[model samples]
Target: MSAIGTRAGTGAAGWVLADSWTMTRRELAHWARQPVRIVVGLAFPVMLLLMFTYLVGGGRGVDGDHAEFLVPGMLALTMAFGLEATMLAVTQDLTKGVIDRFRAMPMFSGSVLVGRSVADMLQSVAALAVMTGVGYAVGWRWHNGLTAALGAVGLLLLLRFAMLWTGIQLAMVAGRPEMVQAVQILVWPVGFLSNVFAAPESMPGRLGAVVEWNPMSATVTAVRGLFGNPGGSGGSWAAAHAELLAVAWPVALIAVFFPLAVRRFARIGG
Candidate 1:
């Protein structure tokens, strides 16, 4: 009855928004049937936090308190670790023909990936909240004010969004559900090769430079600064400009992989 609805239906941007929301709802409905997956995803990072903080011992080159250094790093790592969900979801859908159904529906072309990104980001937010509570219980308080803390959370989610697209593209390339398991082996090295558990300075000469330059390390350092956490300072330019790289790295990644994933999905959809 309204021109607004008719206008929305007539535009590219509006179609994408409308279709993405519909697909987002589809993902939310799936969540009810996959409660165990969400729980495991959230719990896996917590287990890592507990293991490193207590059983494994303290982080190297962590100044002031190790737990403070740990909490921020773990937050960044937790955001990244959830990429498996995106990877598995994409690969499984590709194999099971779920994506084909969506493509056949006359929906907006990018809506499928957009919806998946939305669902994953929401799941990541819940995981972050759980992680924050666990951090507080472990005596990891943010010395920064509330605004800064919020900024830290924003940066954390931004990195996850970038990683989501990267994971989607990687999963598409792998082309099967079972290949995801092998692909997962790469996540561990990518997670650890950065400055997550240990400071770059503590790593050693050239290796430390590589660690400092890792895109994940940039976010960790940026968030650490925003949260007023410890041990983010570095001798290298990349580490020094963590704030800039935190923004740049994710933007660059999305630019590269977002289109790649869309094109790859097009192949299957046809």
Candidate 2:
């Protein structure tokens, strides 16, 4: 009996994985059909990187190369912004009844969300590569070795994973494509409130404290440390232990939003 139950659990897991892959393929197909969307998604952050590196110029309290400071911050910003795309896609499916159509089939319900996340993560990787190339072109280089660079990448993607589910939960609640645009605007504040373009130390006292505690700030600081970039070190405890908060913040967010997104998705059409 125990053996039978174990096999049943394994089979259920396999079923979900297979269905999720199928849905992932369906999402990738949309990328082909709508190449402009993918291009725009990838390009926006690159444009921002160039704009800041050259046009805006100078980082307050940044000790060394501004590119060193800016590049990691931009990567974290890109991850924060990636949620808009996820939000838009989820709400579009919800509004157009695509999710409803999928629900009519025998596929696993949560697989749809899982598949969307996988496809979004793929785009995010591409975005990071593009941003990294652009950063290198603009004179940003990781002083750390390859393994540390990969660790930075892992943290960036972990933050993106957390943001992905947050977007999904928000999209499910928004329930319409047009509403997504309005809802997504809220992300910009969260992005800019961090110590992305400037050091938290440079800000006014209370505001600097707030910036230091930002989850995005934690990620930017942690990634900067891993990449051996400037602006990673800080006097504050938040700055001193950024790597921990980087992991913990995202885990906390996922712990809250992943289940919320799944629960909300389950209630659709019920």
* TM per candidate: 0.90, 0.92
Question: Residue 222 lDDT in model 1?
Answer: 95
Model 1, span 1-270: residue lDDT tens: 655553433677778788889989989999998999778888988898878877654433333377788888899998887778889988877677566677776678678888889999999999899999988888789888999999999999989999899999998888888888887888889889999888899887988988998899999999999989887598889988999999999999999999898887777744
How does residue 151 of candidate 1 score in lDDT?
92
The C-alpha RMSD in Å for every predicted model, in order, reads 3.7, 4.6
> Across residues 185-239, which tens digit of lDDT does each residue of candidate 2 receive?
7888889999898888778899889999999999999999999998836689999
TM-score of 1: 0.90
Best by TM-score: 2
| Weakest ten-residue segment in model 1 by summed lDDT | 55-64
For candidate 2, the TM-score is 0.92
Clashes of 1: 0
